[model samples]
Target: MTEEIEQFETVLGFQIPEPLRTVHNVHRWTRLGNSDEESIRSIIARYIEYRRAIGTDDLDLLRTFRNNGNVECIIQYLRQSIRPMVVNTLDNSVVLICQPGGTDFHALASLFTSRQLIMFYAMLGEYFFQQVITQEEISGRESGVTIVYDLENFKITDYLNPYSPIMQIFRIGIALLQEYYLELLRNLLVINSGPIVRVFLQLAKVILLPKAFEKIRIISSSNMKERLLELVSSAALPSAYGGCWTEVDVENVNPLTCCTIRRPIEGKAPPCNIEAAEHVNLSAGKSYSAKISATKGQTLRWIVKTSGKTEFAVTLYDSKGKGEAELLIPRLTIATPLPDKVPEVGSVECKDTGVYGLEFRNVNSSFFSLKIRYGWVLE
Candidate 1:
């Protein structure tokens, strides 16, 4: 192996992808979040989070994925699968809709390995995030990404088998979309939701997040098109549903093999820390707060802004309310670029494992409403 590859394995505890062997290639993928060197413990914590998000307890499989630990195979089918992906013309959200009867489930499953399916998770993972978040007219008023699972002709055998690849892929997709891809998933709209889909979703609530599923829209097949058009544009739906793109054959895996078939919902959410969000409005001299509790080596990240006026300064405070914060950030006075209520965002590593407070101070004399979203790294 090359020295650079060896370095990647040693430092990140994984090999660099074949494409990212050179310094230039490393910098390319590194541009996202673009952090400096981190501790091994930090890397371990992140990997653990990924594993939980994908509903996988297989430590070895988690460690030895496609190219290495971080990067996975950049398969063409992933990008080519236009059936599930559509950009919302209204909110500009990425709509990953599942078309029932559109793709052959069994054949689709036969196309890729269980590893690659998860790699599809890793490859396209965080892939659309930067593009999704940055196109902000105003940072605070960001658009949302949505997943529309259209189970129009889905039968019980489709997802009943717990071991099916579709179920496996579904598990990974739902968990990761819920856990790692926080705040971005504005809604998980389920169109063409018949009794089965409804019951499936209800059962899924146990294995998945009740809150995330709360964002689901279980509409009838007849109303699916009209309802979706209200939120998304015709562009986001399949041509059969009045969009430009043609609906492809439903290609997925339906594992006929199964155990006791009486189960309603199949799996459960992976055990891990969750990202949180809340909406806040403040008046002049008033303040709002969101806090992240981090250990000695963990990191705390926060983003906040007011809708009416961007007159806000978000500061960090240690558990002790006595003085200024101990951690460091790039900016103290996070400003919204003129005309845009762009949020002031920053991340600071904790010096100690204590509950830290994030105070969104509204120095403005007038009242303003703001949304505060935050989370911290923990294992």
Candidate 2:
């Protein structure tokens, strides 16, 4: 395999980096069944060019984003703007599970440009490659990753139309994975597929390479557990999918958490002591507000869990003492906390010196008062 890689490099007149030098990595090209050396060389060249084009070739910058709070605001923004997707790495496989039906696709489209989304994905890809693929290679195991897409309730309408903004984002994500990270994928398993999912797969066929499309399997919900157990261990699989592990178990094993670094402390002694959780009882149709003064570049971080659905918003008052207000976070209904689930975590860097107001409105029509336990820190 090494000799073949050397021969390919000599013919192509380019050095293949250490990251792509493994036997399994090189074999991934042949898996495409394009036996022609010139065609394979062109594909490899294109892959390398795409990586450089996205600035993912700079490992240090990617690492900075992974371990620092510099991009914490953007990370939180992306999470709140879109449907949450969980990236779980178990052994040689990475499972990507999408939350069921919470995201507003149109709102997400208007929130960010295609370039911003691609850059975010680039960071995630680099992290997965360094943490998952590199570790596997060092252990003398095959370097390829088996990718599983758990699309139980994923809506096809948001992604099927080519003209839709969500579809545009979908294409960008798929193109990035196919063009730059194709070699890392061993096989793609898509569980909990229905008739609508089959229709979506037909669209996927048009976008994916023929060889790559052939590697996808659509498993029904009935046999999903049995089929997944063949690829993932019960210890690694989520309990929702007939496995023994809980959501917390899955979170603990994820490698991407390192990318969402917590707020840093300056000295051994705490900069500001942790505040006690403030309890608020909001009556129906009433709103609660908490104001804090902040300067530019400071981050406002909060953790809140609500007893019922509530609308939360953040406003920035101008430093000039004018009554003008800028809605930092528009009023949006927050999901009620589930048993043992993590609280809603959010953070945004202050762009101007102002008195920031955090408001919570009881959006529910029910007569019962909404209970909220929340805490905030400006760092």
Off by over 4 Å in 2: 30-33, 58-91, 245-379
- Local error of candidate 2 at 59, Å? 2.3
List TM-score per model, in order. Answer: 0.42, 0.55
**Residue 194 error for model 2, in Å?**
3.8
lDDT of 2 at 288: 89
Q: lDDT tens string, model 1, 216-327?
A: 6666677766777787677666555555544433232111210011212222222223343556666666666556656778766544433332322223465466765533
lDDT of 2 by residue, 93-147 (tens): 5444333233455444444433344456655565555544555565666555455
CA lDDT, every model vs. true structure: 0.47, 0.59
Number of clashing pairs per prediction, in order: 14, 0
Task: List the candidate 1 regions with Cα displacement exceeding 4 Å.
Answer: 1-89, 100-112, 137-140, 163-169, 243-379
CA lDDT for candidate 2 = 0.59
